[model samples]
Target: MTMSEGDLAVTELAFVRREQIAPLPPPAMTTGPLAWVRDNLLSSILNVILTVVMTALAVWVIYEILDFLIFTAVWSGADREACLASPAQPVVGACWPFVKERAAYFVYGSYPIPERWRVDIFFAMLATGIVWLLWLNAPRRDIGAFYFFVIVPIVSYILLTGWPLIGLEAVDTALWGGVLVTIVVAWAGIVVSLPVGIVLALGRRSRMTTVRTLSVIFIEFVRGVPLITVLFMASVMLPLFVPDQWSPDKLLRALVGIALFASAYMAEVVRAGLAAIPKGQFEGAQAVGLGYWQMMRFIVLPQALKITIPNIVNTYIGLFKDTTLVFIVGIFDLLKTVEVSRIDPKWATPVTSTTGYAVAAIFYFVFCYGMSCYARATEARLARSERR
Candidate 1:
């Protein structure tokens, strides 16, 4: 098998094994991150144009926003005296000092000045519980559940609306306003509506004709009417529905209306998720001999609810914002608080529009944006898990 000197060897066979240096290949660009940007972001002529336009638009928007918030209004240079100056000679900028002066009102509303510490404690507990829940991989999972379902609610409720057992003075819901009212209404709506929504969704999917019909009628009836009308009915008609001897609190009445309205929308959202699930999943549950509740609790709902998380989050955001509509029912929420502040004789001026609106905008942005971010993160995590 020796190849004497017979073959000069084909192509570069000899050199292949030799330590001979070959010419380096010409450098070629790769479609890595940079190339990805060039393609998707700047691929076609139209895309390139769009990119340029968007970049310009973004820069222009930033410039204008900064100019308004910083330079033109002299927000950075405004002193305390300048800020608290009469509304007549307004700075035309954000009345941040006004917000600062009434920050307590914004947070706890007219809750007793001495009891504001309770608000602080409630917030601290809420924040801690939320953080604990987020750290689900911790060994304190069971503890976390207890804190969430039991401790947190009890603590928050007691702190917000005191208790005779704790020797604390009770604060009436009627005195609640500002962000406290917002939080109360939003949280109550979320808690109450979710279970109701689940029931309604189940009813809509039930085999029983009467239950299904009832669900459909309820959903359609609520969905067809505007929230304004629902609020009106709650304010005017809810009392009549109950016995005169058992009059519901105005806040409770509004809560019922909100819960009912929110549940109808949430039911639709959940129904969409339920519909997306395959029929085989149900049959599989049946084949396994899982009872209806067990099948739904373990098998069907987990998957359906996961699919519906985005929709459900959207519904939640809608409900949170819609709680503002309780103002129409004479229930003071965050928006209503601002509305009240705008009418203050001292603060009522041309700038009142700007100040009240700016404050409300900031609050709304915080809640809505936080919800959106949470949904995005949840969606991303679910996507990654699916991949794995």
Candidate 2:
């Protein structure tokens, strides 16, 4: 029964430590930016190839864009001659002079120069309302909401179209063109789409047979048709329903078409978000003695809308871009203005069309990208709040 000294020595060597060991630094290859690069960029041969190829492609694209936008772009001149390539001038990218000369036309699109101040005031008021409403923590948000939802549209009509009774001579909607027209169409679509879409979404889910059926019919009919069809019908066919003199403004008709089309798409986006919400949410709201409308207004709808923020913003961006389609019906939005100006004998050059389109592209990109970024930030903020 006696153990040998060699056996006791082996048992002593295998003893466990009682105290905790201090943590050691991770290996250099697995702990720093190098580690991140290793794991994400070069973890495999395929990944390494993809990373390298994509990086080079991005660099080339960026360089080409900069070269066209800045390096070779014409900065100033008096006429078309400024943009034309010469033996001395060599390469020319954008025709800045053309854009500069026709800047007013691009923005106002033959809106009476004498009355353009009204458009300016309209812009100022719109900017004010948008800033106030979008500032998140802005003071007097209720007032901002009132100004945006109520006062702006009403006042904008009277201010821009003019109230002759108030000494402001009537500036016909026919004179509305360019940025003014684009903004009008987009603003109407974005503002009108959300509330209308919410209604349609709720209707689709409602137990009432008539409301649900009507909502389904409308959403399907609108979604089933192209925006062009709606616009054409609005601008051309709708007038047939009324006497010639009583027909609505062409711009107004287009506005209605765009709003309706956008609302239909928005309804689907919202419905998807609503579907994602658990039935427990509805039950919980009801259990708290909240009426259907109150439960939706205070609980369900907010969560649904928040979840669908990206989709909603995406729809807004599409509607914004689709404003260009108004030109088919003789309504001159920003793109139409660009189309008209590019053919002018005074500023026309090889680059004129390219330049005009470039400006429109930049404008659309800025606005769309802004909306996207705002939506992303909103999503992040909501996520943080939920985590808290």
Per-candidate RMSD, Å: 4.2, 4.8
lDDT digits (tens) for residues 1-388 of candidate 1: 7665546454336544557678985534454677778868888999999999999999999887665455544233223444444557444555555566566777777889998888888778877776787664766877986886688888888777789897889988888778877777787778777778989999999999999999999999999999889878987887788898887778877877888899999898888888999999999999989999999999988898899998899989988888888888777787887777767665544545566677788789898999899888988999999999
Q: Distance from true position, residue 211, model 1, in Å?
A: 2.1
**TM-scores vs. true structure, each candidate:** 0.84, 0.91
Candidate 2's residue-wise lDDT over 208-323, tens digit each? 99999999999999999999999999999999999999998888889999999999999999999899999999999999899999999998888889988988899999999999
Count steric clashes of candidate 2: 0
Judging by lDDT against the true structure, name the best candidate.
Answer: 2
Q: lDDT score, residue 67, model 1?
A: 57
- Full-model lDDT for every candidate: 0.79, 0.92
Per-residue lDDT of 330 in model 1: 79
Model 2: lDDT equals: 0.92
